[model samples]
Target: MNNPTSGTPAPDGTAKPLQERCDNLMKRIDLLITIVDRGKGDKIVQALRDSRVTYNLSSVGYGASGLALVDMLGLTSTEKDIIISVVPEERASEILNILLYKFDLDKPDKGIAFILPISGVSGPIALKYISGLQQARP
Candidate 1:
């Protein structure tokens, strides 16, 4: 049998498969989801756009505060806007920091943001969208 990975053994002393090596060569992608008070999605999206982020989405939701005090204060069902953005892992931290300061997310009730590591992506369109490489392709 022939090994396409050049017999390079991963740290565990076992040769990694060709497919894994190919995947590792590709850029890593991540998803950033931010939940903010209603009417704030535009700000986040605009900031991302200004930073050259090409792909992002937003949806409406309601915050379910389970605290009795919140209920008494009529804060149980607060309108929320969920914004989701996909970017390469290399730029995820910088983008997150921009969001944090731009939206005052560090303050209480301001909003919340998280980054999820993507295992794999399929299709050239999706890859282009996430990788922000939409140049001419044959």
Candidate 2:
């Protein structure tokens, strides 16, 4: 469960809901998660490392995302690392809850993120693992 992105210095920079209706003309996007916490966010990073179902791109949160004061936009998420992944429609909600609760995604400025539509995935095994993690829930 080692996270390769762990300890990696982020540029110090930089979603939506699982449901809530998206635009019919807009393209479906992948699930992108940006985790963060004030003081030290390494623990959350380690937690993601331990239970990650999928790992895409992870980088340090900074810049505008860090300058964010409210949680509506991802600007407030720059305090930590951003993890992006692609998950199926059915599995998106579960992943959201995990980040929101399992990872406390709703901690306001603590660091919040959202998921969008995913067109496709390059790694099916990785997708399966992520879906498996969602299914193995409490």
Candidate 3:
């Protein structure tokens, strides 16, 4: 029997180890995730660009507050935009500030943003695309 589920085969029949496969997904990167009202994704993306955070992606999604809120609104779900961006650690704070102050996220229901720390980074192509590596300055 060919144990296809065991691992991912590169080219030949041999399966790549799980650790090796996971390594490809790791990157010394931090992710900034923002959830905003529908049609507000552009604002988040613009802020990232303004902060020089070049690598980012935005998508539409639905937000569920809770059963009570859902009942109060008489709606099933609230439309929202989810923006994900891979940023360097040093720049995360500044980008977040722009999204908060400039975009008025501090106000209620304006939306929220947070940063998730990444442990390890791999994949040459992704690294190149993100360009997250920082050159030491004197």
Candidate 4:
């Protein structure tokens, strides 16, 4: 018999192996981190949503500068917004471009964004939710 879902026949005429089905469902995930001046977290989150990202966390942060000038200018600890988002590796480049060009992250003081490969996740359910394969629970 053949596997109706994958349209591929099992070698021994049995249900397709779990490994084969899992291979097709798994996708590499990356962590996209963005830091911008205060009050920009909401905008960044919206941008990620527009790009089809399903998981993101935003938090407030403070920037510490060692320069004396910064202290004199009262800017040693500047308020910032830190946005961490989970995105698929395949879409990393496209989203980075959006941040660079659309958000002007390439310029000084505009903001900064980068991607880090995620080695593992909790399980398939978490992976599917983060990768946008399934809707998040209300």
Best by TM-score: 4
Model 3 agreement with the true structure over 65-129: per-residue lDDT tens digits: 75886668777548999999988776788888888998898887788999999764565556646
CA lDDT, every model vs. true structure: 0.79, 0.50, 0.73, 0.81
Task: Write the residue-wise lDDT of candidate 1 on 1-138 in tens digits.
Answer: 343345456657766676765444465789999999899899889998887777889999988755878778995558999999887789899999999999898988898999999876785457767667553122
lDDT of 2 by residue, 1-138 (tens): 323333434344322222211211122335656556543345544544555444555666653543334545543434556666654556567656666776555665557767776655445335445444435434
For model 4 the TM-score comes to 0.77
Per-candidate clashes, comma-separated? 0, 10, 5, 0
Alpha-carbon runs more than 4 Å astray in model 1:
1-25, 135-138
TM-score of each: 0.74, 0.46, 0.67, 0.77
Residue pairs in candidate 4 whose N, alpha carbon or C atoms collide under 3 angstroms? none
Best by lDDT: 4
Residue 138, candidate 4: C-alpha displacement in angstroms: 20
User: For model 2, where is the 10-residue window of minimal lDDT?
Assistant: 18-27
What digit string (tens of lDDT, one per residue) describes model 4 on residues 68-118?
787788965488999999988888999999888888887777889999999
lDDT of 2 at 36: 61
